[model samples]
Target: MGYLKNIAIAVLALSLFTFVVLFGQLPALRKTPLGTLQRALCLHLPNGLRSVDSRVTGGNITSKSRRLGQYLFYEQNPVVLILFLFLLTGSAALFLWNALHRLPMSLIVPLPIVLIPPYWFTYLCATDTDHYITPANHQDRLRDYPYDHVLFRPGAICKTCNLVKPARSKHCSLCGHCVAKCDHHCPWVNNCLGRGNYSFFLALLLTLGVLQLYGAYLSYWILKPYLVTDATRSLPWREYLPELGDAMVEAVNMGGLSIAGVGLLAASTAALPLGLFAYHCYLIWAGMTTNETQKWADWRDDIADGGVFKTSREALLSHSRPRSPEGANGAASTGLAVHLGVTEEEPQVRWPISSAQVIVRTNDGRPPRGQETLWTQIWSLSDVDNLYDLGGWDNLMEVLNGR
Candidate 1:
C-alpha cells in the first residue's frame, strides 16, 4: 500500500509538471483560467522566489539560480532527452515484463513496430545538419521562401548570423544560428525543428502520441480483469461511493494499483503530444507555422487598433529598391522597409512567391500617405491573404516532402 501510494503520487506529480511545462505558454490557452494559473505558478512563483532570494543574498544568488534553471531546461541540454528516453523505454520494458505471460504474442509484436519510427525520426531530426543556415550558404538559403510582406517581410537581417534573414527564417538563440522556416526549438529532442526537420518532428509527435495511448490501453487491459473481479463481490450498488473506494483500496492491496497508475500516467501524458499534434495539423491546414501564427495574432491585434493598412503588392514591387547596409554578399537588402509602404531607389529583386497585398504598420494609426493604389482597411485577419497557403493537400505535401 505504501509503495503503491508513492507510485501514484509520483505519477500524478510528474503528469502535472509535464502539463504545465508544455502547455503553460501556449497562445490558445493564454487567456484561459488554466493559462492564468500556469503563468502564476510557472512565472510568478519563480519571480517571487527570486525577489526573496535577492533580499536575503543581495541579488547574487538569484542570477545564478535562474541561469542554472535556464541551462537545465532551455538550453540545448540532453538531460530532458535522456529523461524522456528513460521514461519511454523503462515504462514499456516494465509493463511488457510484468504482462508477458498474460499478453499474447500479437499484442507484443506491434509495440516495437509503433515505437521505432518516432525513435528513428527523433534521432534523425536531432542530428540532421541541413537545418542550420550558415553564412557560407546564406545566398542559396535566401531563395527558399519569399517574404509574404505580411508575417514576414523582406530586408530583415539576423544580427547574430550577420546575414540577410530569409522569409520565415528566424535566429534560434540557443542554437546560435538562423534556421530556415524556423519553428520553436524543442529541448526534448535537443534540436530545432526547422525547414529541414519539421516533418520528422511532426512525425515524432504523431507516433509518440499513438505510442503513449497504446501503452495506456495495454496497461489498462492487463489490470482490468483484476479490478473488475475485485469490485464485483466487494462493491455494493446501495453504497456506491463508499463501495467504489473500498473496491479500489482492495485492488491496490491485491497488487493492481501499479498497473492502474501506469495506465493513468500514460493517458495523461499522451494528451500533451496529441494536443500538440492536432494544433500543428491545424497550423498546416491554415498554411502557417507555429512562429507565424503568433505573428499573425499580433497583426490581428494591431488591425483591431487601426494600426494595420494594406496596399497592392504590385505597386511596391514596381519601384526600385536600394540594397540595405546588411546586404553585402549578393544578399537582398535587409531594409525593404515594409513599414514605409515604398522602396528606396535601387534594383528590386523578385521573390519566388509574391504576396498579393503589401501590409504595413503605422504608429499614429493613420494609413500610409501618397499612394495611388487603394489603401484598404483591414478589419480582420481573414481579410488578409496567407501567401504560404497552397491548399490543404499541398500544404501537407510541403511538410511531407520537406519543402
Candidate 2:
C-alpha cells in the first residue's frame, strides 16, 4: 500500500506539471519579438521544420500547405503532443527515482537536463520588442530624442542594472547582476541558464532523459534475458557438478553478461537529447513558458509571495500564517523551533506584507552601522527567523532580527 501510494502521487504530480506546461504558460510567452540569436538558431533547422518556413518557403499549396503545417506543428501536432507527454513524465520519473535512491542533491545531475524543457520553452516563447527592433530602427528612434537622457533602447531594459536587457536576460538580486537571456536559477547546475550556455542545457536534459529511460526499460522482464543466457552457459557445468553450480554463481554471471547492452545504451543516449529538442521545438511554436503552461493560473499570485510571480517581500507575507503548536509531536516541535529561531526573539518584524520597506533598529535600540549586508541590518533590528519568513525585510538578517 505504501509503495502504491507513492506511485500514485508520482503519476499525479507528473500529470499535473505536464498539463500546466503545455496549456498554461506557452501562450503568454509568445508575445515577445524574436531576437537575432534566436532567429539564427531557428534558421539552422531544416526548412520543413522551421516555424516561419511554412510562410516563407515555396510549396505546391505554398500558402495553404504552409498554414496547415503551421497549425499542425504549433496548434496540434500529434507527434509533438505524444513526445511531450513521454519526455515530461519520463524526466519526472527519473528525477524522483534518483531522489529516492538517497543521492546527494549536488550529485544528482539529471535535474539540469529536466530543467531544460521549461527554459527552452521560455526562450522560444519570448516575443518582446528587443527582437523586433533593429540597429537601423534604433538610429531612427534615437533621431527624435535627446542623446543625453534617452534611456529606452532596442532591447528590454534591466531596471536594476540600468542597462538594456539582452535576449533571454534576467536580473538576479542575490548576484546583483543582470544575466543576458536568463533561463532560471538552478542549484543542481550550480550556474545560471542564460544565452551563453543554453545549448549545453539542452544537451544535458536529453542526456539525462536517455540515461533514465534506459534504466526504466531495464526494470521490466530484464531478468528473463539474463536467466536464459546464463542457463545456456551453465548447463554443462551444472550437470557435471550440481553441488558447486549454485544459483548465486549463475546470478553473478548473468549480471556481468554484456549481450547487446552497449547498443541499448547508445540508442538511449542518442534518443534522449533528440527527443527533448524536438519537443521543445513544438513548445516554441505554441509560445509557452513551462511555469505558465503547467498552472494556467499565476503561481506567484496563487502561492506565498516569494514564488515565481510575487516579489520577495510579497511572497513572504502572503504565505505567512501562524503555525499551530497544538499537535505537540516531538518532530513537529523541533521543526517549529528551527523555523522560528530567528523571529521569536524579535518584535520589529511586524510590518505590512505589501510594503518594500524595512524597519531598522538595534538590540540596544541604537542605529545600525553603515556598510552592512541587508541581512546584517535586518538581524540587528529585530529577532527574526529565516529571512524568508517575513515580507517587509529584503535581507535575511531583517528576517532574523525581526526589524
Most accurate candidate by TM-score: 1
- Please write out the lDDT profile of model 1 over residues 131-225, one tens digit for every residue: 78997877777777766778776677788888878878889988888988888888889888888799998889989989888878787676655
Q: For model 1, what is the error of residue 349's alpha carbon versus the real structure, in angstroms, after optimal superposition?
A: 11
lDDT of each: 0.73, 0.37
Best by lDDT: 1
Question: Considering summed lDDT, which 10 consecutive residues are worst modelled in model 2?
Answer: 144-153
For residues 156-176, could you state the per-residue lDDT of candidate 2 as single tens digits? 465765655432235655334
Candidate 1 TM-score, true structure as reference: 0.82
The alpha-carbon deviation from the true structure for residue 112 of candidate 1, after best TM-score superposition, in angstroms, is: 1.5
* CA deviation > 4 Å runs, candidate 2: 1-159, 225-279, 283-403
